[model samples]
Target: MTRFLARRTAMLVATMLVASFAIYGALYVSPGSPLSALTGNRPLPPEAKAQLEARYHLNEPFLVRYWHWLVSALHGDLGESIPLHENVSTLIGQRVGVTAGLVLLTSVIIVIAGVGLGILGALGKGLVDNGVLLASTVSAALPSFAAAVVLQFVVAVKLGWLPALGTGHGFADSLRHLLLPALALAATSVALVTRVTRAAVREETGREHVQTAVSRGLPWPSVVRRHVLRNAAIPITTVVGITIASLIALSAVVETAFGLNGLGAYLVQAAQNKDVAVVQGISLVLVLAFVLTNMLVDIAYAVLDPRLTLGGRAA
Candidate 1:
């Protein structure tokens, strides 16, 4: 376990480094000059331009500037947003909670609805199983943005059940505001989890050991808990982790449609305004989150099935 964790930690550090470099390098490769964002695309005097260039290290090589930025970022200074003129870290800190809340709520919905429906489909007969299949199929075909628009119109605009815009103040209000967006974000993910879970559970039930246990007249629930779900946990866990990680990226569309103030919405605005610092900071944060979630999933693999080592080898 110690060796596995050490290896994973080392890989995490290396992945972060590469992500940071790619994010920062995007500024140089992307259309438009970084100075244009600072100057608002207006012409500047030669002397002023030189001063600005020196201040931002525009005169330095890419590697030198990246090194400087990396060093400062290591100290939690992500530099200032070119458009907003506020600290990048400060902006991200302020908005991150909304996105986190949306993702968390969506994850809960996915796990419960997805896994429950999957179990029902695997165990049920005739109409019940058919209904689960139809629901999952339809959900899998719906995109987050389309779901967002429909929910925003029906649930918020017309029905007036939930607030249509903004991240409401306080915990209770925040959850209420985020609920619709979370549902939209989770639509496809729930379908994915359901399908994977159904497949895994069905496959496990067909195993000779599972059949033997069932034939021995053990309680059905006990048989399922011990023999079916336990063996099916790995694939289900993998899909859930992937779905949750993807929510960070998909949150942008839902946030925009619902007019929520979150990192995803902020990222969109920053990208539009060519705010490279804000974009880089947000990208790095999201990348870190994705890698960390995958790491947790790997750890879960070992926990769920003791026969599997932390190194991912079957013992």
Candidate 2:
């Protein structure tokens, strides 16, 4: 376990370093000059241009600038947003809660609806199973942006069930405001989870032990609980973790569509305005979240099946 964790931790660090470097270098490699963003493509006096470049260490070697940024980031300093002129860390801190809340709400909906529907489909026959398949297929085909528009128009704009814009004040209001966005964001993920769960559960049900349990007259529910679902958990968990990790990136589209003031929305705006610091900071944070979530999923594998070792070998 120790060795496995150490290896995973090392990989996580290396992945983050690589991701951060890529994010930082992206602007340099892009079509326009980094200075063009600062100057809005307008030529500045030599002294002014030199000062701006110096301020951002654009005059330094890429490696030196990256090292400085990386070192400061390690100490929780993510630099200042070039356009917004605010500290990147502070800006992210301010908006992270909204995105977190949206993702949390979406995750809840995904787990409950996805897993329940999957179980039903796996255990049911004929129409029930077909219905689940239909639903999953339809959802899988629906993109987030399309879902967002439909939900906004039908649920928020037309039906008046929820507010269409902004992260509302307070817990109850926030949930109300976030519901549509969450649903939209979760639609495809829920479909993915449902399909994966159904497949995994069905596969588990066909295993020798499960068949033996069924032949021995164990209760269907008992067999499902103790054998099928338990055995199916690892794959279900992997899908769920991937879905959850992806929410950070996917939230940008949903948040923009819904006009919510979250990190995703902020990231879009920063990208539009060419705020390199904010873009790099938020991208790194998203990558970190993805890595950490996958790590947790790996840990969950060990918990879900004790016979499996942390190194992914059978004990």
**What TM-score against the true fold does each predicted structure earn?**
0.96, 0.95
Provide the lowest-lDDT 10-residue window in model 2.
306-315
lDDT tens digits, residues 181-269, model 2? 99999999989999999999999999999989999999999999999998999899989998999998999999999999999988889
* Model 1 residue 312 CA deviation in Å: 5.6
- What are the RMSD figures for all models against the true structure? 1.6, 1.8
What TM-score would you give candidate 1 relative to the actual structure?
A: 0.96
